[model samples]
Target: MAIAGASAQSQTYVLDKGWEFSQAGSNEWMSARVPGTVHQDLLDHGRLPDPFYGMNELKVQWVEKEDWLYRTVFTVTADQLKSDAAWLTFEGLDTYADVYLNGSLLLKADNMFVGHKLAVKDVLREGENRLMIRFRSPVEETAPQWDTDGFNYPADNDHSEKRMSVYTRKAPYSYGWDWGIRLATSGIWRPVKLTFCNGAAIDDFFVRQQEVTEQVAKVDNQLEINNVISTPKEAQVKVVYAYGEQADTLTRTVVLQPGKNSLSMPAWIEKPHLWMPNGWGDPVLYTFTATVSVDGKEVASREEAIGLRSIRVVMEDDKDGKSFYFEVNGKPMFAKGSNYIPGDALLPNMTGERYARLFEDIRAANMNMVRVWGGGIYEDDRFYEEADRNGILVWQDFIFACTTYPHDPTFLKRVSEEAVYNMRRLRNHASLAMWCGNNEIYEGMRYWGWKDKYSPVVWKEMTEGYDVLFRQLLPELVAANDPGRFYMHGSPYEANWGRPESWKIADSHNWGTWYGQKPFESLDTEIPRFMSEYGFQAFPEMKTIRMFASPEDYELESPVMNAHQKASIGNFLIKKTMALYYKVPEKFEDLIYAGLILQGQGMRHGIEAHRRHRPYCMGSLPWQLNDSWPVVSWSSIDYYGNWKAMHYQIRRAFAPVLVD
Candidate 1:
């Protein structure tokens, strides 16, 4: 049987046309476009018959009970198949998918954040092939029960009443919210492609460079291979790597004959030039090319570029508490960067250019790290490449957001696939630093039940179920796939009874002021490794705010057009601090500067208070560094992409001169 195809060489294909879709349970047919949302299409045709009614207009209730099907036809030639092996791939699907090829079920996957691929060798014909997929959106009925209360009803209620299972209740705004949009059912939200490759393909690869010295550096390459043929065939694996202008190169070779083979190859580089961040020198990258050949014919090949560096997060025990610090290349360094949300709520809409610009901005700001918030999708490959090239470290979080997730078999399977897929895809990048199991899920448990303070049921569910997934499942998955990196159970929450000690470092998310506490307070106290979130929300610059608000909007005391305005003023103080760095010193000096000065002083005092109490506190990544769609956030900048005075204050605070 011919496994490879000529068309396989071109993995990119237009999947935008010929998609037939409908609401999950409705028999009504609707014409839709791939890589688009159903809501947008409905609006364009004025099919959205209702206005200002929450549940009526955005009724995705069908998705809770049934599946939405998408069908399309594609073709592959015999010659194309003979040239390269191919697999059908989906960049993303809403929540769950059951894929079919020529009416035969091929694969089922549940994670919306991770891509899925299925081997199409036996399913493909000489020409046309029918492709159909049934997607089931997340179970709407599974939302927390307490979320049904009108917008802010629970504000006056007890915390115990609010601690309801999200899976059992309706999502926030199911009754109605200001967004004026209804919930949407399933559709092909991202892109779909057919990727072709040769026999004994390169399934995945991870490179970790360690043991660096003046004369030589030790490198380890782990490659995963899928042998497609029934008869075992011997193959040779070769690796070539080079760094910098002096054209010296390093090479290593291994042999394999197998079904699924995990090969580890070690190589030595002579007089290796290390990759450093912007200020240290050029952010140099070492390019690596790996080729798998059968009888000298290249069967598979992959290329990756990585920086050689060793990083360690040291926690020192002192009388007061523990102090945390980061060491890169054996030298202590301060982590200065922003917390990143998804570039777009709609994952498919993000582009390579957008990723490049984000990295460029981080570089321009003279920052070294970016914390990928848990609320967003695991970014595409392009995002990691930009970070790798720019020498920016990534603090990665698994995708569980603000609340407790359902503990179902399907959920477990989905998270497992996500762990495997993302670990494989990004394992090669040197920029990836740490993997956090989830966001504030554990800590937020305390705030779940109103008045009751703590519910034994909710606590048991969170500790036993969610904790097991992270401590046992996720960590084991990463170790099997990519063993070099570290894993944290959940951000800011130490793993207790159910968690393993292997989960290194204690992290905390402090947002006392913004959520409910007083506006300002002294940070003269220390806590577990401080990773402050939900602080400072500066108004956008005059120019950026003009795009959304009037000039009078700039007045902090005036009634703002939106809640985002209030949030921005909160952030404006920090922006004022950043403005002082401008070359023209007098540019930011004025009576109006008083507010800006106060903002800077507060931020400095907060950061210094944590730093001075060292050993117990390691680093502080403020609530957020950027925005996705420009809602109310504690970001120092506004939606229009203008820096506020706080940006400069952050730069100085995170500067090596201070923390390091």
Candidate 2:
């Protein structure tokens, strides 16, 4: 309820109104809502004759050179400004944005997933201040080359086929992917907050709890602070951490002389309690509060809720081959989970309630992990908070979606900004288990002639370029900021040249049935490490279908809808299925029951195959558990959010040392 990790004095300004928009380099402008997409405004005002028809075409032509400018004014009292540093933060902006304070550039960044913040120290005035922002949508030039392995290209075909062709390219949506929507907005989408701080401010802090022995826990704290005052100040930094009913508090005093300072604090807990995944036990989260005070007056503070547990992936060899298994504390544990996409495809509009419900459903299904797929935006703080509270481990992916994006200087710069910003925002959450570099980027690159594919000169250059970026630049960036967590080079790609020695897991995404061949039964006989992704889909519940369909149309819709229609249904299904999976009857009850049975069988087979292979097969996370936009493929649930039989099958399959 308190908007975790936020300061009490912080004022949330809704920059959801009064935006002026225009095409880039053009003088003509129109007024629109700050938090709404440009397409929505145009449709609502009837600016376009057929709002949905040729939407992507219009988006490509109009959005490329257009920039949406959002301007707003807010006044803060001098008293409030004097005590704490005033900071302006955007929860999210689409593609790219350049923010200005009274026409003075504050921050420039790309990648719609991460939030941005700027210090308004020198730019703020006592009475009123103007904040203007310009958002540039990703242009065709920003798209990767046509021949690039993951690049989706336009086919020479009729308009009817154009929609289907969009998915062939690697760009996030390729224009018409089912889970994707073509909407661009040049204004702020998420909430904007102004925080006032005093003395030294808590910049960042990360807590790592290691279960050294059954009775002993080693906790390490990394704290960073910025000293705003000129004179030296003696301050006490105390960390009070609690797990369930057990709590441990430690305090240390340090002398700070202006500028910046970083401190590491280590503490020991005897007979510390462990956090169990949902159903295993209560999700005992330790509340960590670090307070910095000068002369007993609290100057700055930071708080985080974390679970206390040690997790490691070990390679084991069995009769089948090498497999990967996760060791928690000291015992082997099976991971059951789903793949997650950004809460909303329409940038920055996801609500906290949405995340909460999703986590709750995941727990109800006996899942303990959620893989945040790479194609979507990095999740917000609220997402991590819910996962932490619910004992859900997060496998986070970087923003490099399905394919290779442009390696141009501008695009590279934007990628770096996105990386740094996301790392800074979500690094401290305890729920984050690992950071994956990209999803299938390397595998796709292999098709571009990196290994056995056609070795053209241009293809070589592209492959080498991505290799350097992923193996070198991206890893370096992660090391500089997020050293405590684990990182996977790219999902489903084996380690090759330029890969870091610190890379921990061998991840794979096998689609033996949907993408390649049928029978879908080769996972038990393939390569090792973590079986990161493999899945099959079923239709969602009727209630979920109803959300998108009109009352009259709802009667016409059921779980047996064609695959194409299923793809149009979004993630709203995960929520709809929660009630049904718990036996709460809704509309089309018979269809929901039938779908779940089919899904359950698929999950049982996949998990059984994965478990038979161990040590070499550290874990197996299905292709997806929920749908961002409902189409039928690997997801266990359909677009309408109905539980396929696979959902229950997964729960039983992932149970450790299953008997009978």
Instruction: Kindly give the stretch of ten consecutive residues in candidate 1 with the minimal lDDT sum.
Output: 150-159
Tens-place lDDT per residue, model 1, 381-452, is 889999989988888887765555556676677678778888878877778887888776665554445325
- In candidate 2, clashing pairs total 39
Best model number under lDDT? 2
After superposing candidate 1 on the true structure, give the runs of residues whose Cα lies further than 4 Å from its correct spot.
1-36, 40-71, 140-186, 213-215, 245-258, 406-409, 446-458, 494-506, 516-521, 524-529, 532-534, 541-605, 608-617, 655-660
> Per-residue lDDT tens digits of candidate 2, residues 1-660?
013344433333555444566545766667766566665455556564432222223433364346666666777678766764667777766646788897699987555656766778678888887877777654443434332534332221112322222222122542434434443334455676666666778878777554445687787888887777778888888898876577778889999878788989988878766776655666666788988887777777888876777666555444543445556667776677778765444443456776778787788777788898876667667888898889887888876654444466755776677788788778766567778888777766654343443346546656666776688778988888776566667876553222322123455666553343334344445534566776554555555544444344432243323322424332234224333444533564454555456456656776777667654455778767766544444566554455656766776887655663
Q: Predict model 2's lDDT versus the native.
A: 0.61
Cα distance off (Å), candidate 1, residue 381:
1.5
Model-by-model lDDT, in order?
0.60, 0.61
Worst 10 residues of 2 by lDDT: 153-162
Q: Per-residue error at 95 for model 1, in Å?
A: 1.4
